[model samples]
Target: MIEAVKIKTERLILRQWQDADRDPWRAMNADPEVMRYFPAPLTADESDALMTRCRDGIAQHGAGFWALERMQDGQFLGFVGLNCIGHDIAVKGQWEIGWRLARHAWGQGYATEAATASMAHGFGPMALPRIIAYTASTNLASMAVMQRIGMTHAAAEDFDHPLLPEGHPLRRHVVWEKIA
Candidate 1:
């Protein structure tokens, strides 16, 4: 089993979840602007369930989406880390990197900073052969972050997000990748 890990960047802490992170994580998940690319903002229960999944994944696998906190102020910015694709799709079983932050954290390069750390962890310790990221076609901001972290768009590998029903605006996703 992989060991529980925490990655520290110059301005952020990429670490496992904590009891204190629940409320802020819930608040971020419920923010409409923050969840704009998602199908809908998460309710408290939904947010809690997601948090539980993140916590449990880290416990079981040693790495997963981690809580992102600012080192300077100890604020919960959001989360950025690697997760295995549990869905039955082309990329199933692949490790995917993702992140979500409060609107206030936007345009600050935090996502890029944290994600770079995550990619290193995946490649360095996790020894993953490849890492991938995908988002709704409309989420240019996230796509930009992927690019900033040196992930190249694999347009030919793009696919519909099965969880999102056909014809859903968010179903059409764009894929990006970085190979170790």
Candidate 2:
């Protein structure tokens, strides 16, 4: 097993999601601001399905995208972790590091704080040689975070998202890689 892991930083706690978190998580996932980069907000059923995948990821890999909670009141801020989002090109079974937070959870350093720990866990404890992150070209906030984390752009590796339209505003996603 991956062990019941808990990671703490100066201000955040990254832990596995609970059944009670479903509602808040679903609500966040449905927010227009939160889902703006997304093509569409997830339905309630999709939220449950995502939670199931989140639970399964933790159980299977010992650590996946974990729900981010504030230490003071134990609020469900958001989530940060690694996931094998299948792959593109010659890279197979790619494990990509990603994060998502409620609108209230933005502006603080929580995403970076949680993600920094996650990167360490992925490359350190998990011994992953590298991790990839992809995001919509226009999502400057997310792209900024990736750069802040020292990930470099692989422009030649960019591609149009298969699920999005051919010329959708968010169709082109830039790939960022952190190689050990």
Candidate 3:
């Protein structure tokens, strides 16, 4: 069994994935607005596979995208945590922090709250020297979160996403980095 680790913030709890997360996660992945920065909403199988990857990462590394839960009501908000950038992008092989919240959870500063805790864990317990984040150039919301977490845009490090086709609208991505 995978041992679960939990990180608590004033308003949120970054904890391990549970079977209850499946339906909400799939719904979040299916929301067009939620997946707007990406190419398209994920299929159910794709979402399930992604969750599998998250579980595997936590099992191996003791940390990954911890399931974001609200402290007040124990509601599953989505996920926020540190992940290794496995893709062959500008930030490849580096630890990156990310978040995705359900539509109901937006506009409440939850992303910033959870991300702050994640960064603390990464830079503190993990002893990571630096953390990086990247998103589609047009994703202003995520960019704002990166800034709130003290990540600065590395303009020179921006690159077209290697996984996207040359002409895709989301191909151009901007990178942000924070050094400990």
Candidate 4:
């Protein structure tokens, strides 16, 4: 098995998911604002299952979406890490960097900070040639974060998300990439 991975930033710790994270994770998944870019808010069971999946992914690969914790108070802010693009999107099977922070954590630069560190981990230790990020075209916040972390828009690679039905408002996703 691969060794577990943990990344630390000045103000955040990107580490493996824990049982204590389940409740906050569920609340964040259920928050309308937090889930606004997705199809819908997840149910408690769905939230738990997702957390379990993240935990298992880390165990299997030594690196995956990790629970973001505040270094000062050790609060469960959300998650930020690297994931293999599972969908048959334009960059299928490529490594991707992603983050989802609780409402309170927004506008605090945490996402950018954590994402920068995650990207370094991917390029440095993981030796990935490049990493990609994608979000609904309307998700300006996430798009901005991607740009702030030095990813450039790969406009020609944009595609309608296969999982969403035709004409769905959030189906057309923008792609971005940063080469190592």
Q: Residue 53 lDDT in model 4?
A: 82
Give me the runs in candidate 1 sitting further than 4 Å from their true place.
none
lDDT of 1 by residue, 27-88 (tens): 98999999999899999999999999998888888999999999999999999999998879
Please give the distance, in angstroms, between residue 133's alpha carbon in candidate 1 and its true position after superposition: 0.2
Between candidates 1 and 2, the one scoring higher on lDDT is: 1
Model 2 TM-score on a 0 to 1 scale: 0.94
| Model 4 lDDT tens row, 40-149 | 99999999988988888889889999999999999999999999977677779989899999999999999999999999999998899999998999999999999999
lDDT of each: 0.93, 0.86, 0.91, 0.93
TM-score against native, each model: 0.95, 0.94, 0.96, 0.97
> Which lDDT tens digits does candidate 3 get at residues 26-50?
9999999999999999999999999
In model 2, the worst 10-residue window by lDDT is 84-93
TM-score of 4: 0.97
For model 2, the stretches where C-alpha displacement exceeds 4 angstroms are: 87-92
What are the root-mean-square deviations of the candidates from the true structure over C-alphas? 1.2, 1.6, 1.3, 0.9
lDDT, residue 136, model 2: 84
- Clashing pairs in model 4? none
- Residues 28-132 of candidate 2 have per-residue lDDT tens digits of 999989999889999999989998898888878888889888998989987898888754533348888899999998998788888889899989988999998
